[model samples]
Target: GSFVLKAAHDAYVPAGQALGIDRDVFSKILDEKIAGHPNIEIVAEEVVSLDQVPRPTIVATGPLTSEPLAKSMAEHFGGDFLYFFDAIAPVIDADSIDMEKVWRADRWGKGTSDYINCPMEKELYYKFIDEVNGARKVEPKDFEKDTPFFEGCMPIEEIVRRGPETARFGCMSPKGLPYPETDKWPYAVVQLRQDNKAGTAYNIVGFQTKMAYGEQTRVFKMIPGLENAEFLKLGSIHRNLYINSPQKLRRDLSSRADEWLFFAGQITGVEGYFESTCTGLMVSMFLDAKLSGDEKPEFARETAFGSLLYAITEEEKENFQPTNINFGLFPPLTTDLDGKPFKGRDKKLKKQLICLRARLRARKVASYQN
Candidate 1:
């Protein structure tokens, strides 16, 4: 008989929403949900190694994975197991963005006018930098203090601490992006990228930080277009460890060295709460199908879930990195069913069509499975 084992404190709450809910309330809800399932066994102990467990185990420890298990996994994988201090940027409610102050345009008019750019005057930019530099930051735990942060994903405060000119030169640069009406560039620009399919949320591009939740809300609102911004999720930083999944795991997310072992969630290089949850679901489906001697079901490639799985399992091996669900991971739909070219059409309309097609295909797959 198979059983589920999880550490008592090993909950699946996202770091971005950690400060939003009371810990006791969150834990109680989680415990209640898990208790409804008969197979789950919450072990009030640590999982130090895979060797102590039975075969056919699935590891989904997420970004803040335990040190002992992480060490054991690294030894099992053998290649350069990557570690990075991941900083999550704050997500804002789309309705709260002040459209009058900001304009939508892609840099250099290269792609669709998708990004919301908030221009800042020279004085305002300087003031913003000063505030960010002085904001209270979350202190790392003792174990995480020594781990180095990846340069590409450094916290906003850490970037500001580098130099006053760093932000303007890097993420906040005004070059190649002129205001739509004025046709002039401001001293600095803060860009927000669409975060969901419905355009209900946007994330501050390159503004990932370790700032205290209150401080993040306060300082970010100082930006021109976000004076009354409503935060959907706040910025956070955590020590993330993941295997090179493309090189280490099979397409089914099973270990190449041992078919009995499986990997999922952040440990297998998929990021975000939604993506991790999808992986867990997919792995379960695969395992169930395999044990029952049935053919593995395939997810539609056009769907977000399938695209994320493809990126982690089938992307190039040399520079394998953890990825969140995004349109870039999805396959491009260049033509319609009638073989009509989709080029030179309105980008928003094209995206809508793509999403519609994906949804329809996914429904067909689901119906077939039923």
Candidate 2:
């Protein structure tokens, strides 16, 4: 069934802030792009189930999939796929971090101290927890009320509701690392992890929240190193639906139970609009290769897109969850092509070297393809 485009009057908010679409603009763009395509048709109808569509179908139903279709998918895949309340953490511009108030360190000084740690004194920790508990949060819609939240992805407000000390014991734990200069652990700590290859942004690790956007800014800025932070993106939570891609989908994104059937987008366990778009592109490329009897393209594992595809198609199926593209998903770069050791170097420098190498590898792969 073809969905009608409804233009949203509000500005285009990036995906993960919510599943919002500027429907009117989006629809118009799609219509224009497909204007000259003869085989593409936009029909207005509701698709109730997989049975309604013919074989060799590509499903991109997205996060808000219809109930009947979701049920049909569950039956076809066998066993109930897990449901989770996913949350997005606020991203901060790198230059906005108060570097003097924060220290670079990883727990137990592991792996080049890649994280930025913000220490909070006892009083400050309690105050922060109180503010979080009292902050206004977005209310889940009726349909989303009953969905179970994955333990790993619990909202910060809900964690605070559990108990005042829950945050201290969990993500904010200062168990292994001592506050720099003072030589002692702080009452609590907040960690920020690099979000992009350029090191221009960092996300508050484990700070995924349901707090209203305004409140998120106010509360998060209270962290020691973020007082003057500029948020690139704010925290939010939503009900996300996805299949067990590792178990259900082949490397090419075709269903294991039926090779002709394929899936893409968030439904395939990758998160965000960009990730989903990449999956669609990959699926189309794979289909083209198969139909033309061309050699299957091999994506280099070091590249971001290659890493995301690996995450969805090859990662261990047990405890699998939807993931956004991140360096953690990429294969580690422990040595250079010449076999030189990459350990014991500065964290940021190491990342730079890895990124450079990945880009070179990607270029080489593209050249080979051409």
Q: For model 1, how does the per-residue alpha-carbon lDDT over 200-229 read when each residue is reduced to its tens digit?
A: 778898999999999999999999989999
Model 2, 267-286: lDDT tens digits are 89887666877888788778
What count of clashes does model 2 give?
Answer: 2
Residue clash pairs of candidate 2: 6-24, 7-24
The lDDT values for all models are 0.80, 0.81
TM-scores for the candidates: 0.66, 0.63
Name the runs in model 1 displaced over 4 angstroms.
1-27, 88-121, 130-154, 157-207, 210-236
Best by lDDT: 2
Worst 10 residues of 2 by lDDT: 1-10
TM-score of 1: 0.66
The candidate that wins on TM-score is 1
Candidate 1 local accuracy as lDDT? 0.80
Residue 79, candidate 1: Cα error in Å is 3.1
